[model samples]
Target: MEKEFNGRDLKLGQIQDGNSDYTRYHITYKSGDLTISGIMNIPKGIPPEDGWPVLFLNHGHIDTSVYTNGRGLRREQDYLARQGFAVLHSDYRNHTQSDKDPNTETDVRLGYVEDVINAVMAVKNSDISSLSKERFGMLGHSMGGGISQAVMVVRPDLVDAIVLYAPVSSDVVDSYNRWTLRNSSNAEKIRSAHGSPEENPEFWKNMSPRTFFDRVKTPIIIFHGTADESCDIEWSRETRELLLAAGKRVELVEYPGQYHEFGATFDDFMKRSSDFFKNNLK
Candidate 1:
């Protein structure tokens, strides 16, 4: 019999007998006296002499834990572990179970990158025998994709390969405006304008992935839905173009007629993503 896990098809009940133990940890990081909370998932597998390839996964924009618990135990981290990779997933500051600092609103702009860096450090320094600091990969979605780009620039030594899904593009000003118009009502738009791009040009520029493309040397795989309304497909195309122009290794896969979440075909997305990571991370 066959079973499905995290939207991926796999053999059912194929239990490998061994000392396999998985643990969830609460990690704290300090950013100038501000502490943030994050979750770490360590899988049970043969202890590699050096270290197993680690994948640091960043979730999309959400205040709850649902984004991290996609398909329950078949979550991204768990799925990666089943594939013999150690995975680390974290909640950004002021989101989910993480610490809520009073200055979060002001510091949120840099929260994603900070959280990921802290997560990587936590895994690298942890006592997990199967985790090595030398072999690491990044997997991010939506807002996390933007964060991944920033991570590649800030911590290039910590990441080996990257996989971005529905990433935000360099045309942030226009994209944000379009998002506001399509998703928010006039009243909501008026309220959002308080922190609009015009007012936060620096933040937009600093966080835009396109600004640091030349600094990214890690190979990348991008997945985008052609029919995505939330984040335009042009972002992925532009990113691909930039990476290719720089003589970097980048692969892009487009899902035709797919919407924001890519509908119920998420299984297909994970399969392709897993293959991409496997091929690139090795």
Candidate 2:
């Protein structure tokens, strides 16, 4: 049975001042029955006349065994916060301090997408008068990029712009097939619990961003490394093509030989993302 979502308010709480130009808070927001936890980075100086714009940060997949509270994109979050944007990074359910779920293949890990969307809603409706409820953007890496695409399809007005880094394919079925190639037994279990991709195409279709490209209205900038092994660079290229064909605003920035994590090119990636948000969100 699908759980009921009420889009409840966030119980904002400040954990620390960050001891820098940005203040850090530990946020707890209601996402269904479970309360999710994340770090919110707020600029310490005076707020703009219209309040500070928000940037939702979504991270890539990390092994649960070694994942920490701010695993995938902590550095990127810090950089964004320093750039004068309020950044929120969720731990996501079953990863760190958040709740758990019985996720399956056809579902395509939309739970993480829900967690991110709920977090955005929480910030928009929170009592923090200094944060802008109107202006919002997104930065997603790897699997998080896929989540951002899905979110854009469902909530076109939620974010004004998005930045992606080496994202997975918009096709959830293809992503699941990649997973199955590495772990056949686990893939079979997920398929048995849900239905195989061939038998339950609709389920996969509903979970994929590719199925609803026409609904994506926000402008997006994609950064992909040609040498990336985890997520194929071709996926982002194809997604860019689809979005363009649908008449949506899209741009793809390529890195010649960088890997999935971007390693030495991390700083360049950050600058491009920061610039994109600055230009679009304003």
Which structure among the candidates has the greatest lDDT? 2
**44, model 1: CA deviation in Å?**
1.6
Residue 145 displacement (Å), model 2: 0.8
Steric clash count of candidate 1: 0
Which lDDT values do the candidates have, in the order given?
0.65, 0.83
TM-score of each: 0.76, 0.93
Error (Å) of candidate 2 at residue 150 is 0.5
C-alpha RMSD values across all candidates? 8.9, 2.2
Candidate 2, residues 194-220: lDDT per residue as tens digits? 687798888778778988999988999
**Clash number for model 2?**
0
Model 1 C-alpha lDDT per residue in residues 201-262, reported as the tens digit of each score: 77666556666677778888888999998788987898899888877889888999887665
